[model samples]
Target: MNISENELKMMVLKACRGIGLPVAQAQEVAAAMAASPWALKQLLTQLAKPILTASFDFSIGLDIKNAHILRDFWACADAAYLASPRVCIRGVSSCDVTEALARYRGVSVVAQGEDLLVMVDERPMLKPARCEVAPDEWQQLETYAALTYVPETDASRLVGAGAGLTDND
Candidate 1:
């Protein structure tokens, strides 16, 4: 079947996801493949190996949505993760990772399953680096995260746990 470059990256993404790699990692792998023929060939060879079940064990994770954020965060966090796998991130979600990276500095990003946790330092280098969202836009992001987040099988309730919350709550 014929495919476009974007489609090929998505296919690579799916393959990475199948192995329990988080969305950010899958995206990184797909992007690397798209950028270099040598990387693509190496990835294909690796994918061709005998099948084996393995758990996701990488220590650090990034949860970014777009290329700008991907590049920016990669520049910031790559060394930390490469040095050790114990760095943890506490963060929120946004459709624009590039904007987020540009706006926020001194933050850590962690991946838990398909989710990205954006952890901010207690004292950010820039005092007001966090993005300021309009009420409507903030609502939309919250709704999106709520819809996509899957509660565990053992969990008794949703995140709020019957806290009598509404979209505006």
Candidate 2:
């Protein structure tokens, strides 16, 4: 079906919540600046949202509400994800990542699961960045993650249980 930008966001968010991401995170993705693709393209950047999901083992990505990549944006996104599995956490260094996230605009930090959610704003709804978290949250990403979406599972209570928790996630 031809879904609108907002509809697409809702779909992905639903998927995120329904299926659950590998890393711990919320479902809220960056919204379109305007209701139209042109406005979304004009306002947001190519890699606008860098979400760090906590539900999938590998990673997943989706298109921005309306931003259309003239070229093979899929390839570009694939390459980007391939370049780094955990860029927000592994490549950038957790300290740097968190610091950068706090400073970055349109980048929301939310505490959905046991991880931090990092979605790019204005575009690239998918390919979110998830980080290690539990006792503390990714101040920036977690805040957004918490705001974006919520899953339908016991993962929240089951995550990072170690001996204390079970392997429901």
Candidate 3:
């Protein structure tokens, strides 16, 4: 696709603003696009993929379900997600899912598609990753679900001090 510099710049700015990012963050994103259009394009594409796949945490237990939310969740999961692996969580209330499924292991859940996916070492993370803030305003949740997580991934590294989880088993 032929992406004009101005078009990319506008798209980046619009996306940042639409996501409710602060002025500084929006400007930083815009600057990045202006300075390196190619890199910015790649990042933009990555950001958009969140709508394709996602993993969801039931802790919050959203009262109402929205179709858009489902779409975003899957986008976050990247389609390849299967919610395959899972980690056991203690103190978490029971739900419809199997109980013996609980193992209190490394990661707690894995799904093919959902927004806000997490992974470590490119491996599907079984643990639910929670954040005080959702990176994208489009999704309203403090936690994320996905097929995998990468410890080295930029987002994975930002978890606060001692936010790490250990198997309770």
RMSD of each: 16.7, 18.1, 20.0
lDDT digits (tens) for residues 1-169 of candidate 2 = 2334554444333333333332222122222221222222222232233443322234543322221221122222343344432312122212222323222223333333333334333432322232222222123223333444556468765673456644575
Better of 1 and 2 by TM-score: 1
lDDT of 1 by residue, 1-169 (tens): 2334565565556665554456786576555444332233334434333433322334454323322233234433554434443432223233333223423344455566544544444433323212223344333324433443456663555553666445663
Measured with C-alpha atoms, the lDDT of residue 103 in candidate 1 is 32
State the displacement of the C-alpha of residue 57, model 3, in Å, after optimal TM-score superposition.
29
- Per-candidate local distance difference test: 0.42, 0.31, 0.33
Worst 10 residues of 1 by lDDT: 125-134
Candidate number with greatest TM-score: 1
Query: How many clashing residue pairs appear in each of the predictions shown?
Result: 4, 40, 53
TM-score head-to-head 1 vs 3, winner: 1
Which candidate number would show the highest lDDT if scored against the true structure?
1
Candidate 1 Cα errors over 4 Å, as ranges: 48-77, 80-169
